[model samples]
Target: MAPVTAVTEATRSWDPYERGCPSRDLLDRIGDKWSILVLGELAQHGTARFTQLRKRLEGVSEKMLTQTLRALERDGLVLRTVHAEVPVRVEYELTALGQTLREPLKVLTQWSMRHTTDVLAARERFDGRAGAV
Candidate 1:
């Protein structure tokens, strides 16, 4: 196994378009549906419990939600807090870095809401043309 090397500012590449760039992985993390939704929810509502997230996200399974939360927490985008109580309460909130994503994600969400019908029409047109050929 190769020894791990520290990436300094001078050595780091910021271009996500470049293959093998670390930013590509970061893009992949933030670009996913569940991650975007989770981040948006956290940004909107502040802190939320596991069940609250699951209920809001709808169609997300228990396992998928758990995995998504873990990944977000691991990436330092989400902070998980466990309350010391008989029921063992847990909650998640966006970190400062994660908070920065709110605007961009909100833009994307608004674009989707605004253009969904247009996108569906385009898909239909493409499919119709393809069927004729």
Candidate 2:
């Protein structure tokens, strides 16, 4: 056991490219297509099983989902539990740290959806201008 001490030094900011940085690993984990969707699902529905995740995420491959869940579990973001029953069952959920990311992820999702029309308009304008030139 150790006693706690107070200090007054500034903490470093997260840079995703630094060598052996947890931030970089974190970015890699959350930047994947499946990770975002999985996290979104868990945030919305709480704990879920593999079957449920696959069904809700539509079009996600079993292999990819398994890989993503394993990676998340390794990174301490997701928890995987197995139950011994007639047919064996497994569930996944966000840890406390993982839950914290939900707010930012939700904001990012909302931003994209809310501005989809604007994004489409921008794309159209760019394509139209490119064609005109």
Candidate 3:
């Protein structure tokens, strides 16, 4: 007979710095620009239709929005619902798991907003130096 063992957080290994870590894949998914924007919209609005998402996320093409939604759904971060109506409406919302990410994403968004001026100034300085060289 084999002895039974339990897995705990201490026993679990997930290093994003490692080459083949699963956490790296998850980071790639959520770190994408489209994913961040889409998640931000769903976090703010709760539930939104395809068109509503498209409208809110300016410059996002239909294909990109569809791909982002499908990816989020596959990752279990978002829920997709299809309503049986004359027009067959579809809507998306954040799942409980996805809601857990809201605060972190919100903090990142705030940081970006707060640092835009500094970032732009840095970029301008770099470009000016590059032009002289």
CA RMSD of each candidate after superposition: 5.3, 4.7, 2.8
Give residue 120's error in model 3 in angstroms. Answer: 0.4
lDDT of 3 by residue, 53-108 (tens): 99999999999999999999999999999999989999999999999999999999
Full-model lDDT for every candidate? 0.95, 0.90, 0.97
Best model per TM-score = 3
**Candidate that would win on lDDT:** 3
- Tell how far residue 13 is off in model 3, in angstroms: 2.2
Worst 10 residues of 2 by lDDT: 5-14
Cα error, residue 116 of model 2, in Å, equals 1.1
The true-versus-predicted C-alpha distance at residue 41 of model 1, in Å, is: 0.7
Query: How does each model score on TM-score?
Result: 0.90, 0.82, 0.91
Order by lDDT, highest first: 3, 1, 2
Candidate 1: which stretches are off by over 4 Å?
1-7
Candidate 1 vs candidate 3: which has greater TM-score?
3
Candidate 3 deviant stretches above 4 angstroms: 1-11
